[model samples]
Every structure is written in C-alpha cells, then in structure tokens.
Target chain A: MSDVTGGGSGADDAADSDDAAGADFDGAQRTGDVPTLSATDVEAGYDQHQVLHGITFESRDGVTCIFGPNGSGKSTFLKTMNGIVPVWDGTITYGDVDLTDEKPEDIVTHGIATLPQGGGIFASLSVEENLNVGAFTVDDADAIAERKAEVLEVFPALEDKLDQKARELSGGQQMMVSLGRAMMTGADTFLLDEPSAGLAPRLVDDAFGLIERLVDRGAQVILIEQNVRAALRLADYVYILAEGEVQFHGPPEDLSEEDELMELYLGL
Target chain B: MVDIGLFTQIVINGLLLGGIYVTIGVGFSLAFGVLEVVDFAVGEYVMVGAFMGAVLAPLFGAEGVFVIPIVLVVFFAVGALIQPLIHHVTTGDRPHPLLMGLVFTFGLATFLRGSVLTIFGPNSQDVPSSLLTGGIEVPGLGTFPVVRTVTAVFGVTGLAVFMYYLYRTRGGMAIRAIAEDRTNARLMGININRYQSIAYGAYAALTGSAGVFIGMTFNASPGMGLQYTAFAFFMVVLAGMGYLPGVIVAGIVLGLTQSFTAVYISGNAVLLVLFAIIYVVLLVSPAGILGKGEWAT
Candidate 1:
C-alpha cells in the first residue's frame, strides 16, 4: 500500500516527469504557481433532494482523493467545484475568484476541466474529433495542434486510432481518450469522477498509472473514487465522506490508522 | 408501358425527387441526432418555408430564389427560440423525453398547419420563380426540368455541407458530444443550450429553405405539408433514424418507389405501397434499412 502514493517516488518520479508528461505540465512550474481550490461550506443537490451538506475542503498540489461509500455525496461535491452542480448555499473559490455562479463552460476557461464516469465520450465521434472538442476554449489552431501532439506522446497507442470512433475503442483506450481529451483544454486543474468505474480488473492499474502520470506532470487532480486501495496509493491528501459531511480529511497514512471508520465506509 | 424513353425519364424524375427528400431528411436526421427529438413539426416547417416563398416572392419581384436567405434566418431564429422550450419540457425528472418531444412537436405541427390554413384561406399559392423555369433538353437523355434538377443539387449540396460540419468542424463536434450525453458534455465545459439551439436552428433553416425549392417544384398548398411530413418520416425511418449518410440511400428508395408505383401501378396505390414498405422495414430492421440507427421502440 505504501508503494502506491507519496513518500515512494518524490525523489525519482521528478526525473521521469519531464520526459513523460512534457514541459507544459512541468512539475516544478505547478508546485506553487497553480491556485488552490478551496470549498468553504459548499451546499448543493439534485432537485428537491439535498446531497452535499455544507462540505468544506481544499485540494492539495498533487492528487486529492475523496473516498466514500455509495450515496456519500462525493460525486456531488466534485460537481460543485467544477460548476456542474450549482452551489446551493455556500461559495467555491479557485484561487481568488468565486466560481459559485459560473457555469461549467465558464469554469473550464479558468483552467478547470472535468471527466465524468465511464470516460464520458462522444461515442459516434472519432478520436481526433473528441480531442478537438476538448480544445473548445482554445481558438488558436497552432496551439491546439501542439497540445494534440503532446497528448499523443503521452498515450502513443491512440495515435493510429485518431480516425476511429470513440465507442469502438476498448474500455482502457476510452479512458485514455477521456484523459487525453481533457488535456486538450490546457487546464491546470482537473475534476475526475470515478475514472476506474467500468474498467476490467487488469486495466484498473493502467488507469491509475495514467493518473500517476498526470500527477507527475504537476496538474492538480481532485478525484472521486470507489477503488480505495488504488486511490490511496496515489493520494497526497485524502477525505472520507459518509453522507454529505466530511468525516475525516488528512494525510493518507493518518486515515489508514482510523480502523473503525475505514471499515464502516471504505471496507479498507 | 416499358418504353426505353419513358423508363429513363421516370428514373431521372425519381432521382431528382429523391434529392429533395434528401434535403428534408438531412435536417430531420440532424434534429434526431443532436436534440434526440423526433420532431413532428418537420413538414410544417417545410410548408411554412414554401408559404414564405409564396408570400414574400412577389415582394422581391416574384422570384422564390430570393426568398431563400430570408427564410433561413427566420426559421433559424424561430427554431432557436423553440429549442429551449423543448429542452425545458424534456429535461429534469421528465420521464420519456422522446415522447415529450414527439408530443410537443406534434402540437407545433398542428399549430403551424392551422395558422397557415387560417391565414392563406386553404388555397394553393404559386411561388413564382422565373430563374428556375424550363428544362435542359438532351438529345438522347430526355429533358431534365431545371427546377427539379436544381432542387436535387440543393439537397445533395446541403447533405454535403452538413456532413462537413458534423464530421470536420469543432462546433459540429460539440453538438455530437451533447447528443451522446448532456451531463458529460457539461463536464467537458460545453454549453448545452447553445449547441442544441445551433443544431435545431440549422435543421429548421435547411428544412425551411428546402421548402422554397419544393414550392418552385410544386405549388404551395396548405395541405401540401402532410405529404412532406409523411415523406420525411419515411426518409428518417429508411435512413436509419439519425444516420446522416444513410439519408441519401433512403431518399433514393423513397423517390424510385413513389415514381414507379405512381406510374406503373396506380397513382392512388403509391401511398398504400409506401405504407406497406415501411411496415416491413419496421418489422425486419427497426434499427433502420442500413442496420445502423437507434432501434424503434
């Protein structure tokens, strides 16, 4: 379990970071340059039913994993940050700007991108088209082409499948497309919802590998995950939510010691 | 009945008419593909376009050709306004969005038809277009009416443009993303309402413009809409609902069948034969004639 997250590769991962993720996502540049995402007493929910009950948290520089059982408002909170679910009562701020009233489309322009579960893809669209859609915020064709080239370098397998429809790709490849597509936005921050939801068991590690690569590149990632073991391995900071409230939030090693709550919610 | 000249002429007529069907089907398929709405108002839009030509042509020196640009803008605006209403009724805890959209558009169709009948007084009106008159007589291939040939060109050209927009343009990709899943589209930072309106507006605009050409081909009558509505349905069903490429194939099938049945069998039996063909298609390939669309539920 210790091999999965922080303290394992702080020294060696940086060596591979530059070659693997690229200079645009240079880890050194992101360590302090990116703005902190702070959620203060955020409240939101679907129609007539409240889901998030004044949850407060902040995203760390690396991976911030939100772990919970079913119906724990993990996904809802993530939506609130990305501006998908409107903040019913409280405010969510990225760095200094209050994103409470912003729409998801507006939020991405501020350098925040989101990936829904099942690698939410345009099934009928080709891989190239999917990536192009991600660059909706960016108008410069040269910049788009450069980012596309960078994305292909990260996931070389998708190079040949640029013209192939997304639905035709395997589950693992679709996940790559989702991640690669998000990269096209040139966003500094990411909100990923259940990235490993529908993957085959062997492919789960590969999905986590992609996330680790994102972290290595220095993009701040806020992930909602059910795969506790894999997520904890990548998490620099962890939060456990039972209902809508944050039960515990601290370092990964600290949460592992709370046996009772771990068993009740995470089955860890 | 089997004279070579007559057969070739019928074939030419069928192909040309099929081109017009393609124009209507392209828009109808786009509506279904992007909005997930099986709009019943499709034919009414065409009828209204034809009527616009009828009403506005004389003002512009009686050329329906000049009415195209005006109809495009008007229908696009109307479609954009109506799309949000469709979105409102169909989304958020509304079960059976497909049904809701169908019913809404059906009501819209009725409203459009009734309004035209009321305003025009149930009479056939000519959309005079001197620019698209007569035929190009070929020594061996027979005469091809400039009007039908031009309409076919418009249909095919419209389909080509739509294909380019859908397959190559970034805006087209955004609409496709929304069609796949709205929630995901939002997560990708796509403005769902904006793109949907663009898609519906384009559909309405193209469909309406096709009406002007159709008006030039046939007189603009209040009841002419129902025939188009039926043909549009046949077009989508045969095109495999929402499948753009299949629209051309479906149009050909419809055009040839209508021409042959009207000429060889009985002019009256065309409707009956069309219905029978549709019934068989539904039974055998509910997905579509090309086996590549959402299955009829």
Candidate 2:
C-alpha cells in the first residue's frame, strides 16, 4: 500500500522524494491541519421533498464509508458537502470555515474534492484534458504540470492513454482518470459517491483498491457505497443510512455485530 | 450550349455561400453544444447585426466593414448579459430544461424580429462598402465577387478562431467540462456560469459579425432573417450537432445545392430541395452529415 500524499499546495513536492511512485504526493507531509469536515443536523432535498433530516456527521481517521440502500439520501448528503446540492438547514464546517452557503467551486478551494457516482470523468474530454481540469483552480502552469506528473505516477497506465478520449478507456482506466482528475486538486479530503457503481464485477475490487490508495496517502475520505463487504474492508468508520437518516455509526466491526441493522439496511 | 464560365461562377458562388453559413453554424453550434440552448434568436441576432451595420455604416464613411468590431463588442456584451437568463430557466430540477430554453429563445427571437420590423419596416436596406464592391477577375477560373469572397473569408476565419479557442485553451476546457457534466465541472472548481457566459458571448459576437458581412453581400431587410435561420439549422444538422469541424462540409453541401438547384432546377425549388436533403439526413443519420456529431436530443 502506497501513501498517497495530500493537501497544502497544488504543486506538492512529490519530486523531492526519491520514490515518487509510492511515497511522495505533491505537498510536504504534515503533523496537523488535516481539516476534518463536521456537519451538524444537516437537512436538504430537491424542490419540496426533503431527503436528509438533521444528520450530523464527521470524517474518521482514514476512510469513513457510508453504506445505504438506493434512495437512502447517501448521494444527496455527499452533494451537500460538495455544494452540488444546497443545505436547507444546519451548518457544515471544514476545520473553521462554514461550508453551508459556500458554492461548489468555493468548496473545492477548501481542499475537499467529491467524485460523483461512476468517477465523474468528462467522457468527451481527452484523458489529459480531464486531468488538466482537476487543477482548474490553480493559475500557475508549473503547478498544473507538477500535479499532473504526481497523478500520473499513481495511475501510471494513464500516461500512455493521455491523448485518448476518456470514454474510450476501459472501466478501470476511466476510474483512474476520474481519481487522477480529483488528485489534481490537491484535495486533503475526498468525498466519493458510489465509485464502484457502474464498474464490472472484475473491476469492482480495483475501484476499492484505488480508494484504498487515497487513504494510504493520509487523505481523509468519506465514501458512499452499496458494496457492503468491499467498503467495510477499507472503512475505519462505518455509517449506515436508511431513508435519509443514519441508522448506525461506529466501527466497521460494530456494524457487523449489529445483525438486525446490517440485515435490515445493508441486506447483509 | 452550356456556358462553362457561368457554371464555374455558380460553383464558386455555392462554395462562398457555404462560407457564410459556416459563420452562423459555428456560433449556433457552440451555443447548442456548450449551453444546450437551441436558441431561436440566432437569426434575429444576425438581422440586428446587419441593421446595426446599416445604421452605423454611414457614420464610418458608409464602409460596412468598419461596424464589425463594434458589433462584435456590443453583441458580446449583450450575449453575456442574456446568458444568465438562459442558464436560469434551464438549470436545476426543472421539467424539460431543453424545451424551456427553446421556448425562451423563441420568444426572444419573436421580440427581436418584431422590434426590427416595426422600426425598419419591410424595406430592404443597403449596407454599402465601397471597398467590397467590384470583382477580382481570375484569368480562367471566374470573376470572384469581392464582397462574397471577403464574407467567406470572415466566416472561415471566425470558425478557425473558435476552433482554436475551444480546443487549445483552458477556458475551452472549462466549458467543454461544463457541457459534459455541469455538477462535476463545479467540483473541479470551474465557475459554470462564467464559462457559459463566455461561450454564449463569443457565439453571439461571431454570429452578429456574420450579419454585417451578410448585409454587405446582399441587402439587409426585415424579412431576410428566416432564410438564414433555416440555413443555420441545416448546417448544424448536416454538420452533426455539436460537431465543429463538420460545419464547413455541411455549409458547402447546402450552398452548392442551393446555387445549382436555383440555376438548373428552379429558384423556387431551392428551399424545397434543401428541406428534402435535411429530411433525408435526419432520417438516415441524426448524428449529422458525417455521422460524427452527438445524436440530436
């Protein structure tokens, strides 16, 4: 498992380390200021229908996997954090900044990157252009190149296929592009919703492997997934949501022990 | 006996006529491609631009060419201003966002046409450019009318510039990303509204400038916009919806068909012939003439 470096600068000095392929992620590793996101009693929905009702949440040490059934409001909760969906009531704070009213573009600057279901790569864009888009907030050309270089090291297969349109890539390769695009932002925390949703059975493990790599690097991740056991393997904390509310929140071991909750919500 | 010179001239006219369509198609395609708005006001934009050329040409010593720059700026600003309105009606959990956009732009088109007709009446107004009058005579090819040649040049040049901007720049990447998935684009820290505005503004600026050149080529009149509007639609459909490179080919096909049909068939049958081709293309390859465009939704 490689430690994927996260945060601080668009151009993290991954080049400074001798083994950039495994260890160095753009920014210099730090002791603190990891910027844990805390959401309190968050309520949101589309139009008049309410999906989430006062669900308070926080990131765990490494990966916090949110497991839910379809229409469970897990995806909507992720969107609220990313600002794709607005929070009707309740406060979301990233370290000290209030993210409740912040726009999606603004949320990215705060170093929280969300990858919507199916990796969210712009299908028509070339792999290279999709990577370039990751650093959309960065102005300096050198930073973009450096961040891309760092991402390429992680998903080295993408280097050869940079010029090809993203849709042309295989399932696993598209996930790499999607992950690689997100990495371009220097995000300290990743909000991924259903990263494995559309992937083939053979590629499902590979999708979780990619997420594991983000966690191995020290980035805080809040993942929403339907794959119960696959997500549990990577989860430091587990959240089970049923009908837009948290049915359970604790260690993954505890989640398994709650036979009734697991059987009812996760269909375990 | 068939006059070879006349035939050659018709061929040249058709190709040049295609160039004019290229200008309108590129902008219309961009608006549809980037913003997903089937802007009904595209033709009115051209009409207004020609009227601007007509009204402003005299102040610039009746050189219609001088108004291109000013029209580009005015139209760009107007377009930028209008883009938010389009974005407003088309975004969020709205039912039939595409239809909403079409209807809004349709109303806008009607308003613009009515205003121009009321102000200018039904009279055809000349946008005189002494510099563009006369013909450049080639020894054997044909006499290329200077105005048509320049108009063609303007159209092709605008297409090239748009091509370069869309494919080679960061701003281009932003808009393309927005076109692909608006929510994800916002996640990438791309301000969706700003890029949409820029895309629409550039489209308006180019389309409006084409009007000035068109007015110089023919006479600008209140009733002239509908024909060009139909031609613009034909270009996009034939070019492949949202496919940029396909525009030139679509334009040439439409132009040559119009020129040849008007001469060999009937001046009245030109519209009928173009419609027939469009119908066939739609039935066969809804993706576009080259079968490379996004399937028209």
RMSD of each candidate relative to the true structure: 5.4, 3.0
Candidate 1, residues A139-224: lDDT per residue as tens digits? Answer: 66655786788789899999999999998999889999999988887777788899988899999999999988887777889999
Superposed by TM-score, candidate 2 places the C-alpha of residue B231 at a distance from the truth, in angstroms, of: 1.0
What TM-score does candidate 1 get on C-alpha atoms? 0.92
lDDT of 2 by residue, B176-228 (tens): 89888888899999998999999999999998999999899887887777888
What clash pairs does model 2 have?
Answer: A4-A217, A12-A26, A12-A27, A13-A26
lDDT of 2: 0.86
What does candidate 2 score on TM? 0.95
List the pairs of residues colliding in candidate 1: A4-A233, A5-A233
Worst 10 residues of 2 chain B by lDDT: B288-297
Q: Per-residue lDDT for A1-268 in model 2, tens only? A: 0123332343454554454444466533432446778899999999999999888899876898888889999989998999989999999998887999999998898888888888889999999999989988876676677778888888999989999999899989999999988888878889998888889999999888888888777678898888888888888998888788988899988877789998888888
Whole-model lDDT per candidate: 0.84, 0.86
* Fnat by candidate, in order: 0.73, 1.00
Residue range B1-297, candidate 1, lDDT tens digits: 479998888888889989988878888887887788888999999899999999998976758978888998999999999999988878777989889999999999999999999998999999887788889998888779999998899888887887788767778888888877787787677889999998899889989999998898988988888788888888888778777778889888888998899889997787788889989998899878888876644
